[model samples]
Each structure stands twice: as structure tokens, then as C-alpha cells.
Target: MHKKTMTFRCLLLAALLCPLASVAQQAPATADIRDLASSPRWLTTKVYIEGAPQTDVKANYPGVVGISTWDPERNRYEFFYTDTGKSKYDNGGGGYFFITGDHKTHVLVPDVGPTKTMVRRLETLNQCEFTYSREVPRDMVENNPLVRIHVVHAPYTGTVETLSALKPGTPATP
Candidate 1:
């Protein structure tokens, strides 16, 4: 009987340690954006005019904006735009940083549109790529005109990337 009890205890101990051993073997998470610069996949940055009517305009000029670095510690992507003026039909118009990984891929959230948001997948980074857009009316042709758009291969030490071409009203895909 004592031998049987000892055997059971040994089996239980082995099961508990197995998970811990596997976790220990895993690599540490990537924390900086520079680490992803050398990767092969193309990072797509779409910039939509804030308030442009007609889905066609938005689709054609789905502004290819700039790229920002991912701060794993903060879990956010710092983005900058060129259109400085404030308007009803403007989405990506100023310099601001968005939550990293949150916008990695295109996600369709309701109340925004049928397919409201579109995102790109970052190869090594665990976060989603993001894009911005504005609501539009059916009749409005030039609801918001994008002035410029840019893309940065990697995050700069201290500078922010610029976005251009203010043609608004691009519907996002789910």
C-alpha cells in the first residue's frame, strides 16, 4: 500500500512541473518597434478623410498614410497627420498616438459602419495595425479632402510621420 501511495505522489509532481518547464523555455516578448523593421511583410497604413460623402471616393483615395512604432510597454502606436484644421468631415487630421495592437487588423465595429475599421497584421508584434476614417453623408462629394499621407518604414527616435491627401469617406472592411 505504501508503495502505491509513493507512486501516485511522484506522478502528480511530474504533471505540475511540466507546465512550468515549458513556460521557462519560451522567449521573451518583443518590446521595441525597431525589431520589426527588418521583417518582409508590407505594413499597410490607410488614412481616411474625416467627413467625405460617397463610398467610392473613400475607396479610391483610402489614404496610404505613415507607419509608427509599437511600444510594447505601453501597447500603443504613435501616429501623426498633416491636416491640422478642424472640421466635421475630418478623421485623420492631427498628430496623435493610438493604442498599439488595438488597430493591428481591420475590425468592423458597429455604430461606426458595416465594416468600420481595417487593420494590418504585424508579423512579430502581437498587436494589430490600424487606420482612421470619418462618417459621411450620401450626397456630399468632397466631405473632407485629405492633404497628404506618408509611411515610415520604422519608428523615428523622436520625430513623427506625416499623412496626406484629404479625400474623406472610405468605408472600412471587416
Candidate 2:
């Protein structure tokens, strides 16, 4: 039993460390996940491959806005967006995301289907602007080195203005 337990522990440690080892060898990314993760302002304006459309989100949603509000309790970023490409915009939504050990260079975005994980790496994050590039399987050929996403901050609206006037703990009207 002792031998079996020791073997199991070794396997578990290897399972964790190998993935992180690769991330550690990589260079630092300019964008801090902390900055993008906390703000409610990110609006996904375009998702493309150099000049071509790359994802369905771009095809379906004309003004595809993404919003993230910091969840102080969870310690993870929650993604919100205009639902399924129908875009009256900013109805307040939620989503899931995962990050790697380095907290830079790599980001795991939940894909549209089960068992499929879309991997995005940081390209550029200039102030409120952000760009992430996706990785596709090697069997697929492409001119673009990256499948990219572009985002800029959502402009403050009347709702935002009203919310600003509220006291710290006060909730804005629905």
C-alpha cells in the first residue's frame, strides 16, 4: 500500500509540473491578465485571421461586446457578452475562462463545443485595447501565425453614468 501511494503521488506531481514547465520557459507577455480580468469595459470588436473572418462570433454578432466584472469573492474573471449574436448590447451576461501557471502568454478560453478548448495567447494589450491569438491544430494550414481577437473598452452609457452616482454599496435600477 505504501509503495502504491508513493507511486500515485509521484504521478500526480508529474501531471501538474510538466505543463507548467513549458509555460515557464516562455517569455513574459505584455498584457497582465489581472488588468483585463477585472474591468467591465472590454468589448470584443473583431475576431479575424489577418484579413479573413476566423470565428462564428464575428459572423453572427455585428457588435459583439464582451464585459468582465471582477468577482472579489471567486478570485476568477467572469465573462459577459451580447447573447448569441443578437445585439441590442449590454444586457449583462456571464461566461467562463481559465489561465495558465505563468498568468501571461497563455489563456484558455472555453470553446463553443464540449471537449474542445480554444487556446489564446496574448498579442498586445494597449491600455483598454486587447488582442489574443488562437492556436489551431497543425494539420490545418494557415498564412496567419495567429487567429486574433480585438477588443476596446465599451464607452460609458447612461446606465453607467447613473451607476456612478450610486453610493458604494447601492445597486443600480434594473
Candidate 3:
């Protein structure tokens, strides 16, 4: 083929593949929660008040915790976060959020299926509470993946923006 013809064909092919490349680069979809044996790596996050100083928030925030199973053959593990707050300030039932180590993808674990819910402190910020008990046993800690759970609080404004600052793979400075 002529040089000009080859160049034109290459440009066309590049343009055709650009969209596919972009889609592949996009963030992956939320992970489908599986019902595996109870995982002992459960964790909870500290509640940050609406007007509390950022310094206080960071100091109290419980950062990512590692998750793994005791059996060396086990490949996947699970952790749970229960969002059972019913603050009058909450417009709708807040859902629990979990982030992976990549710090980009997050999954909004809903209040459906096997999840047990609770409501408390209807008057205070922690008016609602629930349990996401992990029953599976595994290694306490080691070469395990870290997960960050962000429990949705009432007055859901800025909650996501704040959580974004706390990367899932990074530990909170105490």
C-alpha cells in the first residue's frame, strides 16, 4: 500500500479503537456481594459530626483494616458495615458504602436481602444502629486486602466528599 494510504488507514483504526480504550479505562462496576462463610475481618467507621473540625474527625476516624481468611487456600474474604442510624436529619434511609484498595471504586451496600437493620438514637446523630456480623474466621492480619467502610449518617450533604479524602488503602493518622 502507498505510504499516504497506510497512514490514513492507521489513523482510522486508531480512531475506531479510542472509544473502546476509554471504556476499558473507566472504573469497574460495583462488586457483587457474595454470601460466603462468615469473615472475621469486620470493621466500623467513626461518625463525624456536621460542624466538627476536620482535625477532630481525622483523629477519631478508624481507617482501613485488612481482610483475609485463616485457611491459606481461601482466596476471597468479606467484611460488613451496618448503617442503622435514623436521625431525623436524614432525608432518606442512608445506605452503607465500602471502598476497595484501588481507592477509586466504591460499592453502596444496600439495606436489602440478608442484611439486618436497626434504628436507635432517633434524637441524636447516632439514632439508628445495626449489626453486620461477620461469622467467617480467618487470619487476624497479614497479606490481606484493606477495606474502608463509610457508614452514611444523617444530613447526607458532603458525606461523600469527606469520605473521598480518606483513601481506602491509607491508614488514618492517630
Candidate 4:
């Protein structure tokens, strides 16, 4: 029984460490984003947009707009957006960074449309109203490198101002 237990522990350690080792060695690719999303341990970031303030409540904030996952490694945030063609733009694709309520955590948003309209919209706001959750018990999504936020406003509003009034997101440094 003791021998079996020791062998099991060693195997578990290896199972965890091998992935980390490989991640550290190479920058993530497009396929990696898909893999991470499909992983049983994938994380989901809850997106929100500001809505009409309720006269009934002193402070009313809108709920999540959408949810999406990205790489959880802090150093790898840029890769998730840059590596995936989903985020590309004609004038050199880049991303936007929005800090959360804590003033420490950040979310990287990529342009989801044909023009820089999304970028222009992000410029209007000041505070990001997004949040995330993790599925795996062993991992965390907070303060980690999350990328590729595709803001979706239902019913196809032609104007970005119609979305929310939370805060603007800064463009990721080239």
C-alpha cells in the first residue's frame, strides 16, 4: 500500500509540473487558446456593461454581458490576443487593457469587428465592469493574464455609447 501511494504522488506531481514546464518554454499559439478554453480547468471571465441606474437602488450596476476564457498565465496575456487571428486588425492588430475594481487585475480586450470602433468605444469609459470565474478547483482566474474579450451588445446597437457608461480601456502598448 505504501509503495502504491508513493508512486501515485510522484505521478501526480509529474502530471502538474510537465505542463507548466512546457508553458514556460514556449509562447502560446492559436491552438493553445482553443486548448485552454476546452480544458476541463478552463476559466470564464464574466463581462458586463453599464445600464440605466435604478432609482430604487442607491447604486445600480448592470450584470454580465458575456463570458469567455483566456490564458491564465500573467506573462502570457498578450499572446492570447496576438496569437489568435480572431483579434487581428488591418493596421497591425493589438489589444486593449482594462483594470478591474481592485485596480490591480486587468483584462485584455481585442477588436471584434472590422474597424477600430470598439477601440474608440473603450476610450469613452473609465472603469471596466468585467469579472471572471474558474472551473478548476486547483486554479485561479483573478489577477491572472486573461485575454481576448469580445464585447457583444445584443440587438446590434449602431453606437458604442448605447452599450454602457462604466469606463474606457487603454490600448495595449505595442
Best by lDDT: 2
Model 2 whole-model lDDT (C-alpha atoms): 0.39
What's the CA error at residue 54 for candidate 2, in Å? 14
lDDT of 4 by residue, 1-174 (tens): 643454355445444444443422222221122222232111122232223122211111111222222333321222212112132232223333333222222333433333221111221111122222211111124565533322222221122121111224633321
- Model 4 ranges with Cα > 4 A deviation: 1-49, 53-69, 78-85, 89-104, 107-174
Whole-model lDDT, model 4:
0.26
Instruction: Choose 2 or 3, whichever is better by TM-score.
Output: 2
Per-residue alpha-carbon lDDT of candidate 2 for residues 25-94, written as tens digits (9 for 90 to 100): 2325544555554444455666554345454345533332454343223333334434432212122222
Higher-lDDT candidate among 1 and 2?
Answer: 2
* Native-to-model Cα distance after best TM-score fit, residue 8 in candidate 1, in Å: 41
Evaluation by lDDT, superior candidate among 2 and 3? 2
For model 2, the superposed segments whose C-alpha errors exceed 4 Å read 1-30, 51-57, 60-65, 68-75, 83-98, 101-104, 109-116, 136-174
- Candidate 3 lDDT for residue 45: 32
lDDT of model 3, residue 23: 33
Candidates in order have lDDT scores of: 0.30, 0.39, 0.26, 0.26
Question: Judged by lDDT relative to the true structure, which candidate is superior, 1 or 3?
Answer: 1
lDDT value, residue 46 of candidate 3: 38
Query: Clashes per prediction?
Result: 30, 0, 12, 6
